[model samples]
Target: MKRLKAAVIGCGAIAHNCHLPGFQKNKWCDLIAVADPSTENLKKAHEKFKIEKAYTDPLEMLETERPDAVTVCSPNKYHAEQAIAALNLGCHVLCEKPLCVSMKEANAIKKAADKAGTIFMVAFSNRLYKGNIVAKKALDAGKIGEPFMIRIRFAHEGPSPGWAMSDWFYNPEKAHGGALFDMGIHAIDLAAYYFGKITHINAMVGTLAKKIAMEDNAILQFRFASGKLGYAEVGWTSKQGFAGVEINGSDGALVVDYSDSVQLVTGSTNPSGKRVIRKKVIEKNPTAGGWPIEIDHFVDAIRKNKQPEMGLQAGIDSLRVALGAYDSDKKGKTIVVG
Candidate 1:
């Protein structure tokens, strides 16, 4: 019932694929405008979303349109500035993740969010999907019985020449870390969603495939506050294979396939002294990624005037692990993520 004006920054793949479309479909939102540096991207946004106003300068757009909400889908290098700008304007912001490339920028944005008093959510889309929801609920209900470990693999054939508008993802200065920061953050946040706070982290990262300045692949190991162990294998070079999430627990193991299916495995002993493995499909909702649900959740948080369940703090925590992984890779030693 509360239809509010909303604008978006960066008209790249994320903006066109999710942010713009999500705002368009939400009845409670009026898709007002968009801002991007590229004329081609702005033209596409206009032709597709039929946006009335577009700006090359996002700050000018924010000042002029003054939308009630904004989604930051810009490059990793620009997230801190754009997000801080929107938050300072007292607008709800759903920032795409790996929050920022550095802790200094992260700290600055945190202060701004603290002062803004508006809902700020990090776009950790993987955790909001149906399969993850079912797995989380079952884990909470003890269906998994004292979950102790998790493994999540999210890999793809790189962003450039495909999903990304630009090749900033391959630039170490822009992206900070390659697949580790890009795809790995999602896995890291999803791990935190199920296991809570992460205490220590170590990783192996390198540019194994594409000749990029940043790493194209990374393997991260995490230790949660609950003493749970987790590993995430993220890369931008997988043509085909496993790229889903799994959690192993005391009772059984829960697996969420790449296509949104949750399977639980429990073991039994046969009379012949052989071990038996039984698999049950507990939830299956094959769909695209959780961008729409994530946007809807952002809007709902605004309407309810409540801080999001996973807000800036969660973003910072996940970033800590991600940055720590980079450090671990550099030092060849585990890093304390306190």
Candidate 2:
């Protein structure tokens, strides 16, 4: 098979740190061109990877290069337009999560993907995390029997002008929402991935850390289709804390510490009737997140003419839950998810 010519649409920190390297690592793909409005970012990428083709406009790059695969790492607002354009060009796409800011945009991308008959995978990177993968396999093997509840928390110091490529993350129009959309969206998707499709959401969002219009912190309560319960928290203000997933079931539980380790947790009563807890280490730290395998998965799907697990509808389903969280915060009540 010939190497796939791949082009990246956004050359921000994410593109540099994750997407670009993921594609480059794949033996099946060649990193051909990169597009970013910031000439500095393009130059930086070129210097790092020796990529020659650069364009200020993504559509120009797409039209001119006509790569076999496209990774949309642009801001929230640009995902729909860029993804649709690439799909129209009959290219397989790997889009960053929150697919777009709204369901309308997701639908548009879906229509384009359907028309193109190409693979469209979302970057639900958490699902590919080593701990999550190990824990999920354990659950599938009945290590956690009949899992009924879950909790996932993902937080960081938040994005700043220094941390991100630009201040677009603070802009309501560009980012749509703050940590909930950026960080929380991952948790939203993970909850669904473990339990099932989320059926309802109750949420609260606030701009506690930054003086921004959008929320910098978010908390969500979820009810899955299986009638299971889940709680998720995502914040941009945390300096330090435990960030991971905990699943409880009829049997023992699985504790997945993000990027760290997976543990099997069980409890028993001592002879004195004192309760005892036990934890057995399962998998150790993973060197990287899902990014590397994610790109390979995308390229493989493209080659096989199959849709990856995190396909277009999976992206949309999770986006629906994330957007519903915002709606829940606004309506001051639980939002029923479709």
Candidate 3:
């Protein structure tokens, strides 16, 4: 098997912790180069990963190395430009989530991907979780009949004091938005993945604790095309991290406490006219976080010439919801999503 040559465009925390390590772990991938504007980050990544080539300019790296695939882990503002460049260069792209800061950029990236004839996958990692996959299977199997309502919450302490590699997250110009774009995007994508396309959105966004230029917390209500109602709350001001999703249906309920486990509870009426309740707890592998799975899936898509599960269209759809949330908040009313 010919190993795929891979390059990373950013040396930020996500690149360092997930993309880089994921490429290194994949037996079919050869991490040949890395590009970053910061000399410190480039040096650190090169030294840590034992990468042979490091360049300050991503375009130069793309032109020179011409890797088979590239992971765009750059700032939110640069995702579309870098991904489009890589795709135009005939390289498959695994871009980090939220796709881009705006719909125009997202559409441009999608167009580039369509023209390039290469796999373009957005890193919506949550969908790769085994628990989530099982939950999806159960839903599809009609274990939870007619899923009508979904609620998701993702919260953590602000990025500045913790894992963020740079302060760019606080800048609206760089990040586009705060928690709504950062942590909230995962919830938004997962909601769409579980439910369906969001037809309308009502949202409230504000900087409740953090002094950032963008909102640090957000609440979003969604009406899916399937007529399912969805709710999401994301914040960077929580004292501790919390991640969970609950789906309520007419027959039963599915709950995924991402920090712990997934559960399904069902109710039935017995022949004696007594109510019966059954609970099943699913144990998820603690070691699985989906980064490796997503990376492997991207590589497989490239090798097989198949569309990725979370392709460019998924990225655009999720971005539409995120941007819709911002628009709804700005207008102080519900916004119709196309």
Off-target runs (Cα >4 Å) in candidate 2 are 269-273, 286-289
Query: Per-residue lDDT tens digits of candidate 1, residues 166-214?
Result: 6687777878778999999998899999999999999999888897788
Q: What TM-score fits each model?
A: 0.96, 0.96, 0.95
lDDT scores of the candidates, listed in order: 0.89, 0.88, 0.88
Model 2 lDDT at residue 114: 90
Order of models, best lDDT first: 1, 2, 3
Could you give the C-alpha RMSD of every candidate to the true structure, in order shown? 1.7, 1.6, 2.6
Q: Between prediction 1 and prediction 3, which has the larger lDDT?
A: 1
lDDT of 2 by residue, 1-338 (tens): 68999999989888887888888888888899999999988888888877868999999999999999999999899999999999999998999988998999989998999999989999988888888888888988999788999999899988885578766898889998899999988998888888888999999998896777888899999998889999998999898888999999998889988756789999977799898788988988732557768888888888888898888988999889989998899999999996
Clashing pairs in model 3, backbone N/Cα/C closer than 3 A: none
User: Model 3: residues >4 Å from true position, as ranges?
Assistant: 268-277
> Lowest-scoring 10 consecutive residues by lDDT in candidate 1?
284-293
Candidate 1, residue 338: how far the Cα is off, in Å: 1.9
Residue 210 lDDT in model 2?
77
